[model samples]
Target: MFVESVVRWGAWSILLQFGLGVSAGFCPPRCACRPDTMEVNCSGKHLTSVPESLPSDMKRLDLSQNKLKTLGRRQFLGLTQLQEMDLSDNVISMIEVEAFQGLQNLRILCIKNNRLKIIPVGVFSGLFSLQFLDLSENEILVFLDYTFRDMGNLQLLEAGENDLVFISQRAFTGLQNLQELNLDRSNLTSIPTEALSQLQSLTRLRLLRLTISSLPNNVFRRLHRLRSLLISHWPSLDTLASNSLIGLNLTSLVISRSNLSAVPYSALRHLVYLRYLDLSYNPITSIQGNLLGDLLRLQELHLVGGNLLRIEPGAFRGLTYFRVLNVSSNQLTTLEEGAFHSVGNLQVLRLDGNPLACDCRLLWVVRRRFRLNFDGRQPTCLSPDMVREREFQGFSEKELPRVFICRPSRIIDRRRQEANIEEGTNILFSCKADGDPAPTITWISSQKTLLSPTGRIRVLSDGTLEVRYAQVQDSGMYQCTAGNAAGNDTLSVSLQVKGFPRNRTMPFFTEQGWIESSFPPTANSSAQVANPYPFDAKTLIIATTMGFLSFLSSVAICFVFMFFWSQSKGQIKHTATIDFVPRASMGGGGEGGDTGRFTMKLI
Candidate 1:
């Protein structure tokens, strides 16, 4: 009985050792396996293929940053327990269908930083439970139709930094639960309104480094649930249509580093619930009055680095709950008191990195320095030699007058000016003002818009308004306000541009009354008029057809002429000869009536 018991115990111990050995054998080479957590990591292993013999019960696997060239079919078929997998930062160019067939539980998958040019349909067919997908930093040219139809639960997708030029309409058909999507750094000239509208639950959409020039009206109307819109690096973006955001209920709107020269008052009127507004890093020179009158709920406004030179009175007329205002890193020398008359509840105000001239124009701000928040960086003076770099907070109420001293501005040539000229005429209006601290000049158009440096109408450095090729639309009263720290002055000039008949050639008349010809003779004396257009296929075809027709006509005329001449040669010939007697014999018959006999012969 003792011998039998020893043999049975030995057999049980051997079986236990074999089970332990089998568990260790399942872990692939150069991989770290945690049996307790059921996870495997073979990342950065220079792996050319998915490691084999991985634990089937592994819930998470990372194979990122390797030399993987392709993900073959059934690469992770047996890893049914994998809830998260990362194959990012590899040279993976091709992913066969069913690569993750059995990974039904995969909630997060990353295939970022690869050479994937196209995400073929069915490549992600079985990932029904995928929630987060990262396709960023790839060479994807276009998102094919139904590429992600199975990923209905996808919440976030990062497809930025790709070479995408177009997206199929049905590419995101089944991704109805996608919320946040990023397509930054793409070459799409316009928004993919159709494909993106499929994500009914999308809230935040980001598009950067695009080439879109203008936002059309109601372009985002289909995005009912969109809340946040961020656009940046759009160099060609300039105009924002009045109704561009008509149907958008966006709470936050950010547009920066663009070519927006003016505030989009018409578009912003629809965003009543918008809280944060950022137009930083644009070329906007002035903030027109009543621009943000409708955005009553707006709390924060940032125009940092907007090159703002002027903020007209009533610029922020309707914002009662305004909290923070950042206009730092700009060219603003002085801000008028009326500019912030409506924003009485203003809390944080940033005016640093600006040339704030200490004068009467800015006295109201200095008096309220204690109440206003400068965001830890106070406004400093750039003029008045004594306080060139001094902060406004440094001076007290009693010392304010002695430190920030300046004379009020007055329009020396203030007068009711008028000019009448035909269209296509160059005109100039000069505005002269006098003050202790020279005031800046800003021209306001008849449409209540600030005129910046444009190719046609430009404001010279000496406050001269130069309007080239003036049109009828240029007619109106132009208000030019010159302002400094002390105060400001205004001068209004009425410009009436008469429109000539369209068919009539518009004259090129200068401000000096010189009549320049509209069609100036070319300097080059070449007989051929310079063709500004390139040779296209149509032009080539026309030229060839004309030449062929000319050749045929010439050949036809030559043939007809030859046939007539040959036929005439076969006709009978007739010759007639008439001979007269000697003139002396004829004269002998009668001196007055000398008649000679005529004879005709036919042969």
Candidate 2:
């Protein structure tokens, strides 16, 4: 009986030890744990504190979508094997300094979608192996200096979509190997140029929703290796400094949905290797001349939903390898063929959603419509009552002559304009014309100088000629010439400055007509005419000059008489004869043109 009891006890002891081993490896309550894979998923649990009894050997922990409000120090003390932790979408507002301490193997930490107003330093301490850190979608207002100083191996940081206004210059100090940083959709007043330059290995940056008006010079000189940059939704952005992007070797750049009124030609002249550019939803009214000649390797260009009126010839002169162009949803009536002649390598052309006139100006596009891909939305006619709403490619070549007709540019108000203006006053000449393709108005000055948009004489935006502080030299027939591909028209505007200067200070009209003065008038000097005095201004000048000459001759005679009397007193026999030689005898000139000689013989 004693042997039987001892054996039974030994069997029970073995079974109890086996049960204890299985209990140690059991899954936590209300949690799914794959002990084989070492991952714990406790997401969406309503418990306020961190889930208890998490597997000790788990490599990934997801505690997101919980009501946890604060993270206490040493909360995750034993999670040494954790390689990734997701604490996003929680009401976490405060984080003790040592909350994530000893997470040396954590490679990814995401604290997004939280109510974090500030992330004090030392929160990310001892995370030596972390590669990606996401602090986006939070209420963080500022990033203190050295906030991420301990995360030396961090490679990517996404802190966009936050209420960030100011960031310390050393906020990203130790992130030397960081390659990508995104601060898009934030309320940053300006680009944190100094703060971002510390990332020595940064290659991509995104900054959107800025409120700056102009980019100062050399803003990106320190970000030397940046390859792609995206800047959008800056409605107040207008002027981009010419040297703003001087040091970057960017391959792609985007500046969209802004208030830019024209192509920043001078600003983009140095982006020689830039291949992709996007300038969509801007207020750019036109693209004129060879403005984009410097972008040699450009492959794609975008200018969608803009206010484009016309694209002048040679606009794409040097984009030899250009492949795609998108200028949809604009106000262009027609595109002159020369606009795309230099872009022969174009494969995809998007010119739809525009008010096309279906005129001869767009025949070149219709001829090549079959060869070029329109990207689903083809060009549609908006004019020529018969062809309105008609597809561009539907029209046959035989039907083009009647539908695609052009009208020669003509001066609607064809009459010579004559005006008399006073000096020191501003004057404007109005010229009106019409044509199939809008005509360009040019004004030629009386001095045969082309009137530009600046200087004393200039052309206004409405094609009116403005002369500021008019002078007498500006008083002549000014020509207003309007020309286009169809034809040309011209009219003369006769401007007479100070026509009746002695009468009044302001120019006035007369009953007969604009009386042309045969010559510049002088003060009345005729004796027959009733005058204030016979010696008027001009008459007095001549009389005074003649009297002064006679006085000079009398003084000479007195000198000659005095010299002879002195010689007689000395009993000197002085016989002096002065003879003058003509300049003709000495040829055209002598030394310094001073050959007028006289000789006096004294005996």
Candidate 3:
């Protein structure tokens, strides 16, 4: 009975061991002894290769930061149920063709910070369901064509911080569903026009290392759906062409650095929807009149780091909706009297870092806009001569001097002339003057007509008058009258209306080589007017001679007066001294008197 019992027990034990071996294939290599609910964790185990016989029901696999050199075929072939896979921070040099052939359900694939030089063709061809692919911080130099052709469902593609110099056309052809593509800090010099042409669905592109100078025209023409574009570290750009961004729908554009000079009007013409623009780090000298008039939707404008020298009167006329304006780090010498007149909605105005010149015109504007000063900030004088020994640091608006003065311009010259009217000839009549007030101008024609109001003549505010499309009947003496509040002046330039070819020939005289007989002889006459004021030279000679004679007469008179006065005083003193000397001896007194008389004569 005992031997039969022992035999049955030994057979039952053998059956139990066989059943355990069959169930081991269904579980991971490390979880064979644990309960069924225990997780199959194989992370950070100095793993150099994908472990064999992983549980088919495993939900998570963390193979991050492993010294993995390469991934071969059938590595993750059995992980059909796997959802997340982390292969980041590894030495993954290469990926075999079918390495992820069976990971159809994988959602997150993190292979960042690896030694990948080039993504082998079709390496990710089977990952059709992958939503996130992070290949950033790798050694990838060039993206091979069709490398991401099958990843149509990818949402985020991070390929930044790589050795990529150029992006080949159609490299992202199949990634139309991608939403965000980060290529910042890639050291890219130029992006191919067709590189992002296929990514129509991309809404955000961060090109952080894209300097303003390397930005090419029409580079963003196809990115009509882009909303936020970051182009930082671009310092050398000066002008932006109007059509450079023809079709982009950008909302926020940031371009910083200190080398930019001018903010071209055309640069932001098409950015009609732009709400925020940062043009900091430029040396913009002037803002052209009506330049920002069309940017009605601009909310925040940052002109920091630009050494701006002037702001024209109408420069900010159209920016009525601007809220925040920062104009720091500039050389703004003057803010014109009406520089900020039309900007009613401006809230925060930052005028720091500028060597502002505090003068009458500037002070007037500041005083008018005192409410715009947020923190009692003041403008400083940049002129060394204006501020004595102490530098012109900023002062509060209340502390600023109430009165300031300006010097007037000096007078140059005045002249008048007349000419006969000539027919069938275009005549140009002008009266030029130079002054600070930009003289008020008027014109009158021979027909007693006010020529300025006529459409035939166009008068510029700067005192330039243009007579357009003149006819023969328009020939007559034209008078140009200009004046300021201080003084008034008039000049008449005669326009001869005589028939042409009749007086075309000139007469030759003995003294004058050629003379126009039909034209009257004015100050510009060919002979006598050659040297105006003929008596000027003779008058100068006569004045010089008279001055020399007068000087000699004055010196002679002074010498005669001094000689007579000295002789009278000496004779009087000598008589007094002889009288004071008493007669000591008769004979001695006689000798002394003779000597004294001789001495007095000599004196």
lDDT (C-alpha, whole model) for all candidates: 0.85, 0.83, 0.67
Q: Please provide, for model 3 over 11-121, each residue's C-alpha lDDT reduced to its tens digit, 9 standing for 90 to 100.
A: 857644432222224443432222243234455556788777776655566677668899997578877877778888889999987788888888888898999988877
The candidate that wins on TM-score is 2
Candidate 1 deviation (Cα RMSD):
15.1
The estimated TM-scores of all candidates read 0.69, 0.73, 0.58
Candidate 2 TM-score over all chains jointly? 0.73
Best first by TM-score, ranked = 2, 1, 3
Residues 1-603, model 1: lDDT tens digits = 999999999985764433222233466777776655666778898999888787777788889999999988878887777899999999999999878888899999999999999877888978989999999999999998889988989999999999999998888899889999999998888888789878889999998899999998877767889999999999999999989889888889999999999988889998888999999999999999987878878888899998899888888877887888899999998787787655467888898998887887788789889999898898999987778888888887788877657888888887678999978888999898888678879999888889886657788888888889898888999989998766889989999987664334565546666363444333442344556778978999999999999999999999999999989888754655565655565336645655466656556
Can you list the residue pairs that collide in candidate 1?
361-485
Off by over 4 Å in 3: 1-46, 51-62, 78-84, 210-214, 235-241, 334-337, 358-603
> Candidate 3, clashing residue pairs?
211-234, 257-281, 258-281, 282-306, 420-496, 421-495, 421-496, 421-497, 422-496, 422-497
Which candidate has the highest lDDT of all? Answer: 1
Q: In model 2, what is the error at residue 310, expressed in angstroms? A: 2.4
* Prediction 2 global C-alpha lDDT: 0.83
Give the alpha carbon lDDT tens digit for every residue of 123-153 in model 2.
8888889999998999999999999999889
